[model samples]
Target: MDGLFTYNPAMVKAALGTHMVTGYAEDTFITIEEISQGTTSKTGCDGETVRSVDPNTRFSVKLTLQMGSPTHKYLLNRYNRDKKDGNGSFPILINDLTGKEKFSAINAWVTKLPTNTKGKEGQNKEWTLETGQADFQIE
Candidate 1:
C-alpha cells in the first residue's frame, strides 16, 4: 500500500564516491539544498494517451556549502578539472536513514560549482546523470 509518510530532515545522509557523510566517522558531508531519492519518467507517443516503458531516471543534487571549507575547495578543484572529461563520472551515496543503502549513477559528472554566491550564502554543487538512472544499489 502507498501512503504519505513523515521523515526527519536531520537524518538525510550523503556521500561522494567512497567518502562517508553520515558523520559516523571523521569524513562527513552535508547539503543545504533539498535532497531527493530520484525521479522517473516514461516514453510517450505523440497524440496518444498512453505511456511507454522507457524509464528516464536522474538524480540531481544541489546544495550550498561554506565558501572556504575544505570540502568546498576539493569539490571546486574536481569540478573545474574534469568538466570536459567525457569519461568522468562521480559515484555518490544517499541514505534515507531507515537503513544503509547506496547507488551509483550509470554516468555522472559535476555540473555546477560556482565561485560566487548570494549576499550571505555559500556555493552550490550539483550533479545530474547524462544517460542513465540513479537508482542502482551498491553491495
Candidate 2:
C-alpha cells in the first residue's frame, strides 16, 4: 500500500519432500544460483554479431543449517541413500511469506555433504543441491 512493509526470516518456508527445514545458520541461511553453460555472443571480423541462447535451466541451492540439526540429519540420510542405491532425488520448494518470492524444483539431489571441522564450538553445515530445472521468481 504505502512505504510500510515487514520482513521476517521465520515467515520464509522451505521444504524437501515431506521434511520441513529449520534451524538455519545465523550467518547465511540459504542461497540459490542459476548455472549457465551455454554461449553468449560472438563477433565476426566485420561488424556482424552472432547471438545465441543456451536455454539451460539448471540451478543449485545451498542451505546452511546448524550442525546435528534434524534438517541436516534428513539431508544426510538422503545423501546416503543416493550414494547407496542412486534413488534419492526429491523435490524442493522455498517460499517467502513476506513477499512474492518463490523457488521450486521438480527434480533435485544433494551434490555433496558438508565438510566438518572440529573446534571449540559446533560449526554450521552447508548442504548443496543441484536441480535439472528450477522455477524461481522474485519481486
Candidate 3:
C-alpha cells in the first residue's frame, strides 16, 4: 500500500506548471513559460485582468498524506524565497473538497527532482485525477 501511493513525476510536473499561475481562483488560467526545480513562469489572471507572475516566484513539489493512510497526494507550491534562503515558508491549502474532510494529522513535505519547461501557448492546461479512496480521505 505504501508503494501504491507513488506519483507519476511527469504528471506532477505538468499539473504544477499548469496550476502555477491560475491557482484555485475561479475562471483563472496560467500560461506557463518554464518549470524547473525552483523556478517557473506564467501569465496569471485575476478575473478578466491578466498579468505576469514570473521569475520572482519559486515552486517546490511536495507530497501529502494522512497519518495512518498509505496514500499520498502530490502538491506544487510557490514561494518567494529559495530553499536555502531560509526566509519564507507557505502552506499549500487543500482544495475545497479535501478541506471539508478535516482529516487528522495530514502532513506535507517536499518532493524530489522538480522539472522545468519553456512557455508554449495553448499548451497550458489543468489535469486532475480521481483517486480510488473515498472523497473525504487523503488520496
Candidate 4:
C-alpha cells in the first residue's frame, strides 16, 4: 500500500452534554489539551535520583464556534445557569470517525464565558472546559 493519508473535518465529531457541536469556527475549531500532572523525577543530595509518578489526569478542551451559532448560544445558556447556581457539570466527548482517536471527560464544567470582540466582521467565540480527569487517546 502507498503511504497516503486523508483527513476530513466533517468526520470529526464533538459533543457537549446532549448537544453535538457542528457549527465550528473557520479554523482550529476544537482543541484538546492535557494538563501536566507534576514532576515525575527529582535529584537527591548525592548523585542519586528519585522518581515519582502522578496518576492524576487533567484536561482542557477548547471549542471555537462561529458567532451566533446554536452551539454558542447553548454554551452561553449553560454558562449563565452555572454562574447563577453551582450545578452545571456535563460530560464531553470528541471522536474522529476517520480513525481510532477519541477524547472524553466524564465530569467537566465550563471554565468561563468566551471573550466578546466586535468589529466590522464577527469574531469567533472560544469556550474552555476543564476536567479533573479525562481519557485521551490518539492513533
How badly does each model clash, as a count of residue pairs? 0, 0, 6, 0
- Model 4 lDDT-worst window of ten: 33-42
Candidate 2 achieves a global lDDT of 0.89
Top of the candidates by lDDT: 2
- Misplaced by over 4 Å in model 3 are 1-80, 97-99, 102-114, 125-139
In candidate 3, the residue pairs with backbone N, CA or C atoms under 3 Å apart (3 or more residues apart, or in different chains) clash, namely 33-118, 33-119, 34-117, 35-116, 35-117, 36-116
| Every candidate's lDDT | 0.49, 0.89, 0.27, 0.85
Q: What is the alpha-carbon lDDT of model 3 when measured against the actual structure? A: 0.27
Supply the global lDDT for candidate 4.
Answer: 0.85
In candidate 1, what are the lDDT values of residues 1-139, reduced to their tens digit? 5866665645666666654433222122333221343344554576545434434556555434444445554555556667665444656666666434455554455676554645655444332323245674523
Q: TM-score of every model?
A: 0.53, 0.91, 0.24, 0.90
For residues 1-139, write the lDDT of model 3, one tens digit per residue. Answer: 5644443222221122223212221232212221323333445475454444443222322232222221212232222232446432233332323223211112223333224323542222232221111112334
* Runs off by more than 4 Å, candidate 2: 37-39
lDDT of 4 by residue, 1-139 (tens): 8977788888999888898887789899988887875558878789798877777788888999888789877777777888989777788889988876899888788899889999999888899989868888988
- Lowest summed lDDT window (length 10), candidate 2: 33-42
Maximum-TM-score candidate: 2
lDDT of each residue in 19-96, candidate 2, tens digit only: 999999887798988887656998999979998988888888999998767998888889999999998889999999
Sort order, lDDT high to low: 2, 4, 1, 3
